[model samples]
Target: MLTIWGRRTSSNVQALMWCVGELALEFQRHDVGHRFGGLNTDGFRKLNPNGTIPVIQDGERPPLWETGPILRYLASAYGEDDFWPRDPTRQAEVDKWAEWAKINVAMAFTVPVFWRVVRTPEAEHDHHAIEKALTALESTLAIADAQLSEHAFLCGSCLTLADIQLGHVLYRYYDIDISRTSLPNLRRYYDTLTERPAYQTHVMISYDELRRN
Candidate 1:
């Protein structure tokens, strides 16, 4: 059994939860960020000095924080060779795509794009800035679109840790109101992800609570 501490709506938490779900691991979660507002609490701060969400602890092991390490820990411990290859070379291959997705896609989309459109008031939106951000974002998505064109998943034909990192954001990417450039392969890949029970349960959650209405 695993213990998780993060709100379901958190993208980082969604990624971890999806991993847990995929591995059929038993776990429990608590809401503790954004509107939940428990970050600065002494207990949470002790669990994670950074006071970040998506922290986890497995049985007697020390608690883990930071989304990347926590996900990697789960993959290392629970993931099979297909999901997170045990071979160093194969592992690097998956890690490459995972890092690329986090740095290129997640970083570009979250603060610059999603927050701009979803968290900011409509009246205060900067359309020009938004367009510029979208332009930059699509350039990265095109890379994934191309990779996905050749293979069914980010790392290969089967889902891997890379997919967890990359695909977690697609739900909001598609649901939000924006003028998106069509990349058929990317759309197909995302559509395939939508069919998964774990993805549907964790990654496809509604973020209405985070909206600035």
Candidate 2:
């Protein structure tokens, strides 16, 4: 059994959960982060020095921190061929987009936009910073839109680690009250992801708890 530490609403945790769900791996999830304050405890600190959410303890192996590596680890260890390829070349292809998604899309929105718009109170919102972040994110998403235009998934026809890395962020991107450029391909991909039970269970969740009144 695996032990994962993080709040369900945390995007980083959600990514790992989505991957775990896709693999149908049974595991225990400990609530932490935000109002759940176990992250500051000595035990949790031993697991992750940075005190980030979504740390995974796999039996005797050392606990794993960081969403990207955790996803790759779970996929490689437990994912079927469709989710994670054994071939190095094929895996590299999936790795590229996973890196892009984490750095470009996830990082762009969570701190600059989501935290500002959703976490911050309405009176204290930084509209200017949000708009700037949105503008920058738009350009990054456009590249994905073009790539999705050519195939059903990021790397190819079937869902892979690449899609898992990027797909979790789509829910907030669409649901948030923000202006977005027309992205038919990205929209189509998101629709396809919605049809997946794992994605719905792990990724398509409300962040109402995270919002300020």
Candidate 3:
């Protein structure tokens, strides 16, 4: 059986768990980050020296860290043709969007927008910085909106690994109490993603536990 180590609330961990759900792979998940804390243990360090959550151990193979690579490995090893695709060009297209989502959209939104607004105390919150970050995020999301306008999913009409990586951030983007530009295509894509049982189960987790109230 495959084993995953991470808290359920982590976005990265959720991405992996969502991929596992989509692949219908049997796996056991253990809470090990955030408030869970078992990362510094010697046993845990043997699996991942960096002590990052979301390390996956498959059978006797070495544990894998990093959400993107872990997801790619799962899709390649266990997923059907449609999930990861076989054609080099098609796979490249999928990879492009996954990187964009992680580097552009996810990174843009999390720290500058989400952490500042949700995790920071109201008195300490930097509203100006938040606005600036949101402006940048809105610009970044525009590219996704443009792509989604032409295709049902990030890579195509069917859901792919790109969607799994990208879609996880939408719940936080929309659910967070932040002002956002009207992104009709992105919203439609997110709404469509939410219909999937895997996405709902993994990506749509509440962040109320992470909030600073």
Alpha-carbon shift of residue 63 in model 2 (angstroms): 1.1
Clash count per candidate: 0, 0, 0
Tell me which of candidates 1 and 2 scores higher on TM-score. 1
lDDT of the candidates, in the order given: 0.93, 0.91, 0.90
Over the stretch 42-150, how does candidate 3's per-residue lDDT look in tens digits?
A: 9999999999988999999999999889989998999777778888898888888898888998889888899999888888989899999999999989999999999
Q: Write the per-residue lDDT of candidate 1 for residues 1-213, one digit (tens) a residue.
A: 898999998889999999999988999788899888999999999999999998898998999998989989999999999999999999999999999999999999999999999999999899999999999999999999999989999988999999999999999999999999999999999999999999999999889988986
Candidate 2 ranges beyond 4 A from true positions? none
Predictions: Cα RMSD each = 0.7, 1.0, 0.9
Point out the higher-scoring one by lDDT: 1 or 3. Answer: 1
Residue 111 displacement (Å), model 1:
0.7
Worst 10 residues of 1 by lDDT: 204-213
Clashing pairs in 1: none
Worst 10 residues of 2 by lDDT: 76-85
Clashes of 3: 0
Candidate ranking (lDDT, best to worst): 1, 2, 3
The true-versus-predicted C-alpha distance at residue 141 of model 2, in Å, is: 0.3
Q: Output the worst ten-in-a-row residue range by lDDT, candidate 3.
A: 79-88
